[model samples]
Target: MAERVVPEGQRRRRRPTKQGAVLSERLIIDTALRLVTQHGADALSVRRLGTALGADPSSLYRYFRNTDDLLLRLADEFIGLAQEGFTPSGDWRADLRDMGLRIHGVYVENPQVALLAAHRTTGRAHETAAVEKILGILRGAGFPDPTAVRLYHAFVDQALAFAALDAAAQALPTPAREADEEVWLSSYGRLPPDTHPNVAATFPLLAADMRDSGYPFALDLMLEAAEARLRG
Candidate 1:
């Protein structure tokens, strides 16, 4: 039998074999996740991701059929983050609040990615797990199965819808924030005294910090309602 021979220089190199060099679907998804989070969804493209990963753009096709496919994975990443953060301690109301706040925090952290994942539902692992957790909490609290499912839908949908809008608002560039403030200032500064009495009198509050207060306030209101339902 002939003995196999090793090539020179290759014997000592730590470079991965062709099989090892092949990236996993997870790796590609992870790269796309970070890219979308930092750069808006529009900023993500197979070519750019390929360039960043030092692989040919076509290599991405091996993992994702197209950019939309990659986006769905990115959306799953957000759900994964929410699942990782979720912890329900058998208290339905508290669990729902915790989930809502956690989801909000996840979106706020990756505002750009939040915009992409906000409304779309892939029913992937992270999302499915999160739903199961919520259902478990509701069921443990004495709700019927159908009620638990309905509550789960409302809770997750409201949280995500609000998160998407909030993130899109917050994700605006610095110049955009400044411009928005300037527009409010200009518009409020010119309000008439009689016809828009309330507007004129409350211009300061009307134009006050629109980002932080409203988001948490809205979340609190939803949680409050959920708690009330559970109590009833």
Candidate 2:
């Protein structure tokens, strides 16, 4: 009698491992995320993930084709988290702002995941749904297809880019992160008044603002530009 050969990424039946833990795609992704969060992105590997799951490393291929596939799924999972419970208020500016903030907040919360997945295009379910929702919002607000797509591209890319940048800072070692936070005060704030007139004059404001993520301001600027285009 011949044994069965399971094809990659097409295994339909969930099975329990030797340790009695049932393996599922969501469970695998969640475990992967936990590993990345606790041990950094370098912790994401076949051996580590299998050990963490207490399953055979080959079992993961049932859900994802490879490490890269798992990564895309993880990226889409972050998108799912961002879009979870989100409802469009029908006001284009407000909706865009809300969505932008949500993306930034979620990514920042999962800094390791953001650091790994922010720049990758995950054409998975959640990513597709988000794209659809944003485009629908823009089109519903009177923008034509081309304009809507352009706006959606800019909006999403800007959000992801800023989120990744902030996440990188957050992912730094504690001392390094603290040092970065103090730069506005220790370096920029203490610049010679005559040598750096503008910075010296605005150091107080910079000190206050530099402590926060700049995503909100950047989001608003993009929304404002979109609003202007819509108006004209």
Candidate 3:
């Protein structure tokens, strides 16, 4: 089967398997991404990836220097996904909010990758572009150069931090997640008012709140605060 690849300059020739299938860097990364998507974070081992690709595990080294290298590739793809369909409206606040949510969207959709490397730096091409786009958004909004850079730093870190935390929660095994939900519904919701009046009063809303992620609300609060700085 033929695959389309945008060649990285001076990269090695595509490696071929005994079955006559060809593998390129994009193919390897795409296969690994599918493996992570089908299984969870636990499915990213080199052996399993090699098995899925129908190649010897050692052959994967031709594309990636190691498992960490593979992860960087995956993370870069995720960064690219975060900006998919993004267009910068002249309204910077709305634009930034959309960007934040989209970045979080990718992480939530691919919790395994978020859990593995959301907070790690890839320094790969896509990641570099993502950074440049964010900084450009901030600068275009009329912030001073220093403020723009500082804001960009905090903005990205906050987005990734929340994404990672939310992804970890989302990635929990079903049994464990159910157990936590049970605690919320039964244990905490049933707290004795004399011993825990505050929790008792808030339990209903808290339990309801636990049904959905808080990333969107948290993102709003962050953006609101950032906008406040701009107004000052």
Q: How many clashes (backbone N, Cα, C below 3 Å) per candidate?
A: 0, 0, 0
Of candidate 3, the 10-residue stretch with the lowest lDDT total is: 1-10
**Model 3: residues >4 Å from true position, as ranges?**
1-20, 39-42
lDDT winner: 2
2 or 3, greater by lDDT: 2
> Which residue pairs in candidate 1 collide?
none
Residue range 1-232, candidate 3, lDDT tens digits: 1222334564454667655667668877888888887797678887888788788777666667777777888998999998888998888889888988888889988888898878889998989998898888888888899999988888888788889888887789889978977888888977899999999999999899988878778878878888898889
Q: For model 1, how does the per-residue alpha-carbon lDDT over 105-191 read when each residue is reduced to its tens digit?
A: 788788888887778887778777877778888788887888788877877877887788778877899899778768767877689
Better of 1 and 3 by lDDT: 3
- Candidate 1: where are CA atoms >4 Å away? 1-22
Worst 10 residues of 1 by lDDT: 1-10
lDDT of 2 by residue, 1-232 (tens): 1233357465654667766767777788889999999998888898899998888787776677678888889999899899998999989899989999998899999899999999999888999999989898999999999999999999999999999999999999999999988888889977998999999999999899888898898888889999899999
In model 3, which residue pairs have backbone atoms overlapping below 3 Å? none
Q: Any runs in candidate 2 off by more than 4 Å, and if so which?
A: 1-15
Model 2 / residue 97 / CA error / Å? 0.8
